[model samples]
Target chain A: MANDPISQFQIKNIVPIEIGGLDLSFTNSSLFMVATAAAAAGFLFLTTANRGLVPSRLQSISEMSYEFVASMLRDGAGSQGMRFFPMVFSLFMFILVANLFGMFPYFFTVTSHIIVTFALAMLVIGTVVVYGFWKHGLHFLNLFVPSGVPGLLMPLVVMIEVISFLSRPISLSVRLFANMLAGHITLKVFAGFVVSLGGMGALGIGGAILPLFMTVALTALEFLVAFLQAYVFAVLTCMYLNDALHPGH
Target chain B: MFVVTPAYAESNPTEGTHSEAGAPGGDAHGGGAFPPFDQSTFASQLLWLAITFGLFYLLMSRVIVPRIGGILEHRRDRIAQDLDEANRLKEEADNAIAAYEQELAEARKKASAIAETAREKAKAAADAERSTSEAELAAKMADAEKSISAIKAKALGDVDAIAEDTASDLVKHLLGGSLTKAEVAAAIRAASGK
Candidate 1:
């Protein structure tokens, strides 16, 4: 029972607080999210504290990450994308740090949960919606109306675009949540196999070898997935920002 | 260190269902899957996420990014200044080199002109000395010629006297008292065509 793979994701309330029938207690997820935030801030602070001309290793990394997102925004959304750099950069740092931290043995993975990921996804889509409408007014609806479509097929295409636009948050949040959830679960399952197999005799220990190797391999894969997921998130955010900045196509 | 409250652990409502189901899809959040699907905890996670995200964004955009940007800008300015200074110094050096070369060429020209004038002066002095010595030699040759002419004239006069004595002596021997001195003198005057 204690080795239940799904049990790893159960939220335990460390500090319980109820306000007007709303559960606002700090759960294990909140604890790690706070920790992730602190770590992200601390990292930025430490790396940039001494901005040397000939940069130290950490300073270069700080600058490189800054440039990385900067270029991404520039390339994906053009000059107009610079406006949202703060939000996108902050999101990148937070998700990247949180995902990497979750790779540790006992750490809670905040991004693995749908609630947290959906909130972030909502934030992106909300910004896109609000900014697009604020800046472009009714012309922002052109985002859903593809240009140059035949009138006969326009109705169908518009419906499809509308559905897809509405599903942005769902898809965005689910992609990250599912990837993290599946990868971690698979890793945990393999680890369980190794434990159960090793509990048997010498012959069972020999069988456990395969699962151990798979677990190690999966850990490496999970690390790659962590980085890749963060990259995908940032890139998609930029693409969404592009739609808002240059509506229509 | 984590302090586990005894009351919290004892009254966990969702514990039995989670361990029993072992399925991420078993809880009400089962469809959503996992802890986030657990509706009881959604508000807290979202609330904390919002708070933390807002704080992080503010700190990153306002504080950290500007500090790094400022440093980068300062360094860039410094580098530009260094480059400009180096260029100015290089131009100054080039001008100095050109000036030095001009000075060197001028010195060379002055030296050659001095040598040329010295050579002309030495040649003129040599020519003057040679003309003066030639003039002195001509004067000496003229004086020697004049003295030789005087000697020749005097010798001729003595020769005439000697010749008359020899002739008188020879005549006395031949015709004992040949002729008197006046007669000889008249004979000599007639022979010289006086």
Candidate 2:
């Protein structure tokens, strides 16, 4: 058992092809990411295809997910946030499905990687920036200035505001990546114990039972973490968008 | 931690050799077994992020938003149609109720008029019947008066005849023979108190 638990996190190139000195290669992680997206699409399409007035189980799940995100956007960002419902809802579903896919055996946890989470955070932050400028023009810069600060402390307050604004991407990315990485590492560690301990005699087998129970409990906890991380990401996105829209508040 | 030491000792046969070799951590795989972070991974991550973000944004703006808008618009239209139908029905009900009330009022007035006409006709008939009865009674009283006058005339003529006959008979009995015409006349005249 020389296999390090962290060693399994290698990004192996799936399709090895070199073109024009630039290695444009798809990796195992990329494959899983695509699979996660495809799964999300198929799940939504199948669940929402009928969309009957009286919903079936799957449709109800889809609708509940929809309503959940919609309510979050409404509550977090206010009524104007309704226009962005589609984007936020898609974000939630995609992240949730991707996270769940990662929880499976032999699957890559895309969210555990810094790059994937950073990209998602950047997109959300970029959208806020673009929309804010587009909607309010030069006045969007006023978001960094506090209205009631004294003239001498204005620069200090503005610096603080800018620092907070700049930290959005890091905070968002780290929150998701840390949660995914921690949950996966914990599961892997416990699984290793179960295998090693169960190989021994009856007492070892009895001791291994604790690790098995812990694994089950952790798996359940991971599932909750998956949903919670997705929710946190979506709600934070809404909050950022709200800030962009109503900078004074 | 003690239990894990035994399991580790059993797994690695070179545990003693590694311990003697002055490796602080007895694990065969080095602590840095995890691959160092590659710059290429960061680049790939950035590329994938851009791709996904673009794709998702396109899908949202093109596909999802329109679908949601259509569904909401259709729902709004359906609600409006329902409300219009309800309003139309309410108006029809109000018209019907108003018409019913008007008809009821008209019917009541007509019924009262009919009753009044019937009462007036009955009074006219009763008045005619009474007048006719009075006229008949007056005619009957006149006929009874005429009959009584005729009966009294007849009784007076009979009394005059009886008186003349009585006077003639009395004169004849007193004289024991037939009296002369003049004397008889004179006696009749004197008896009659002429």
Least well predicted 10-residue stretch by lDDT in candidate 2 chain A: A16-25
For every model shown, what is its TM-score relative to the native structure? 0.82, 0.74
For candidate 1, write residues B93-166 as lDDT tens digits: 99999999999999999999999999999999999999999998888889888889889999988776776787
Clashes of each: 1, 0
Error of 1 at A158 (Å): 1.9
Q: Where is model 1 more than 4 Å wrong at Cα?
A: B1-33, B93-126, B136-194
- Candidate 1, residues A63-123: lDDT per residue as tens digits? 8888888889999999889989888889888999999998999788999899899999999
Report DockQ per prediction, comma-separated.
0.35, 0.10
Score residue A216 of candidate 2 by CA lDDT: 98
Give per-residue CA lDDT, model 2, range A42-106, as digits (tens): 66566656645456788667666766887899998899988778778778877888799878988
The global Cα lDDT (0 to 1) of model 1 is 0.84
Chain A TM-score vs. truth, each candidate:
0.98, 0.93
